[model samples]
Target: MGQLLKWLAGMLILASLACLALASWTYARSEAYLRSFERPPPFQLPIPDDEVTRARGDHLVRTRGCRGCHGDDLNGQFMWGAASAPGLPQLARGSPADFEAALRHGIGADGRALYSMPSMGFLRLRDADVAAIIAYLRSEPVIDRELPRRSLPWAIRWDLARGRDMAMPAVMNRVPPLRLEGEDSPLSRGEYFAMTTCNECHGLTLQGDSAFGDEAAPSLAVVAGYDEKAFEQLLRTGKALGDRELPRMSRVARRRFATMTDAEIDDLYAFLRQWPARTTD
Candidate 1:
């Protein structure tokens, strides 16, 4: 009986050591990734108090869905277990340039390519609109709200370790190419709205993804299943198709898009409905 007790004790020690090793590995790996992050350019928005610019900026903020993740006050919020969004961080402290790069390139302020920021969608935004968004964010009053630090989930780490996903490289890649020409056109306007706002989660292609940072999210292209009225309803009311529980999108749409003008919604719809094929310029 004494010998059996010793064996059990030995097994427990081994299990404890394994757990310690795993914890150490996870901490070390995450730190390494964080350390490797490159700092994006400093924040700078060109527009100041120009009423036209501010109005445009407001339109940009509302239409591009900035208020979705960032709170209504632009203070920032945390959301867990959603279909499309992963754990989002508060950007109040992030510089305007950091925000711009994040919006335009999907690179975080730390310079590591953001696997999460939907830069692809924002890539199509007009320079003026992008500048306007930076302007709006700059004018927002800084509200102090502490957010829990976020990390990659264990399942994602496993996937990364097993080579199931691509590691974010240490370089700034342009967001998915956009169809907007240098001039103001219908397609360009629509593209601008989609890139800056919708693309934050939707792939640059708006193809939609199930996995952002190792969690299960839904796809937006599935909107192919929704009619325009239903789509508008989903965006404005946070209701899913047939008013089912939409979880993530509902919160975002209600918070960010509920105030969007019908014209803006129509433009966004036209862009989304004819996406990929029409916008792959």
Candidate 2:
């Protein structure tokens, strides 16, 4: 009996030691993975101080879901456990180049790759729009708020180290460039809006993604089933044809798409209606 107990104790100690080693390795590898991305070249855009530009920026920020992750006050907000979205107003005080790097490239001012930012969605944002966003963000007064320090869980770190999960910088690289350019037609404008906004929840192509598991978004091709009125209702009130509520889409639309102007909605709907044809090509 004594010999058996000694063996069990030894096994327990070995298991603990193994866990410790695995944790150490995960931490090191995760740090290395984060550091692997090369800092992108500095991007420059002239941030306009004019009210018209700033108002446009304000509209973009309000409708583009910027306040959804960041707090409504532009102060920092706690996201998932241990992760916090930093205060944008404070962060916006940085150079336009720094803001552009973060918005379009997922690169932080510190030259490190960001993790939670959905830069993949914003990768194709027009330079003028980006400049406006930076200008608006910088124009706001910084409201000081205490936020939890951002940290990754051991499981998430392990995933990052093993390449099971991609950091935002890596994900941004996978986003395709805009296909429609130069033309100012409604279709072109709509494509820009959907790619820059919808692609965050939908797939990078706006073809939909099951990555969110139960919250998976269906392809925008589903838009074909909805007439203009139904589509408008979905965007405005988060209701489907039968007034059926979608788990994620309902909430997102009410929060983000609800703020879109009638003209913008018309453009988006027009583009989405023709999305199936574009996919075939």
Candidate 3:
């Protein structure tokens, strides 16, 4: 009995040591992977303090789902286990160049690649809009909120180390460049909105993703099935054609798209309507 007990204890210690070694290796590999990304050149843009620009910034923040991951008050919130979304108000007080880098390039002020920030969606944002967002964020009063320190779980770190999951910087690189340019038509306007807003959940190309299980977003081509009124209803209420409630779409629509201006919605619809012809060509 004494010898059996000794063997069991020895095995347990070996298992624990193995886990520690594996964890150390994973941490080292993930840190090296994160450090591999080269920081882009400094971004220069004038952040306007005018009320008009700030107002537009406010509108963009609210309608663009900035408040979704961040709290409704724009204070920090606990995302998944150990991952906390930092308060934007505090972050906004930083340099405009840092803000632009994070917003468009997925690089944080600390020169590290971000993890969960969806910069791919915002990659195509116009410079004026980006400046306005920073201005509005800077103008807002900082609300202090207590939150846990952000940390990635071992599983996530392992995925990053193995390249099974991509950091924000890597994902941003995969987003295609804006194709429609040099025009102020409704198509271009709509493309801008959809690319920045919808592509976060839908694939980066707005071709839809089935990998989300129950919340898989269909291609923007599905919009062709909806008329003006139905699309409006879906955007406004999150209801589908038969008044069906989508698991994630309904929640996101009400929280984000519901705030879209009528003209913006009209423009987005116009752009999506051309999806068939656009895809064919």
| Number of the top-ranking candidate, with lDDT as the measure | 3
Q: After superposition, how far is residue 267 of candidate 2 from its true place, in Å?
A: 1.5
Model 2 lDDT-worst window of ten: 209-218
What is the C-alpha local distance difference test score of each model?
A: 0.62, 0.84, 0.85
Find the candidate with the highest TM-score and give its number.
3
lDDT of 2: 0.84
The candidate 1 region of ten consecutive residues with least summed lDDT is 81-90
TM-score attained by model 2: 0.91
Quality of model 1 by C-alpha lDDT: 0.62
Q: How do all models score by TM-score?
A: 0.66, 0.91, 0.92
> Which lDDT value does model 2 have at 10?
100
Over 1-281, each residue of candidate 3 has an lDDT whose tens digit, in order, gives 99999999999999999999999999999988877787777767778889999999998898778888788988879987676888888888887788888888888787878887778888888889999998888888898888998777888899998989878888877787766876898888988898898888888888885222236788889998999999999999999999999878998899888878899999999999896578666
lDDT, residue 237, model 2: 95
* lDDT for position 129 in model 3: 96
Indicate the TM-score of model 3. Answer: 0.92
Q: Which stretches of candidate 2 lie over 4 Å from their true place?
A: 1-16, 210-214
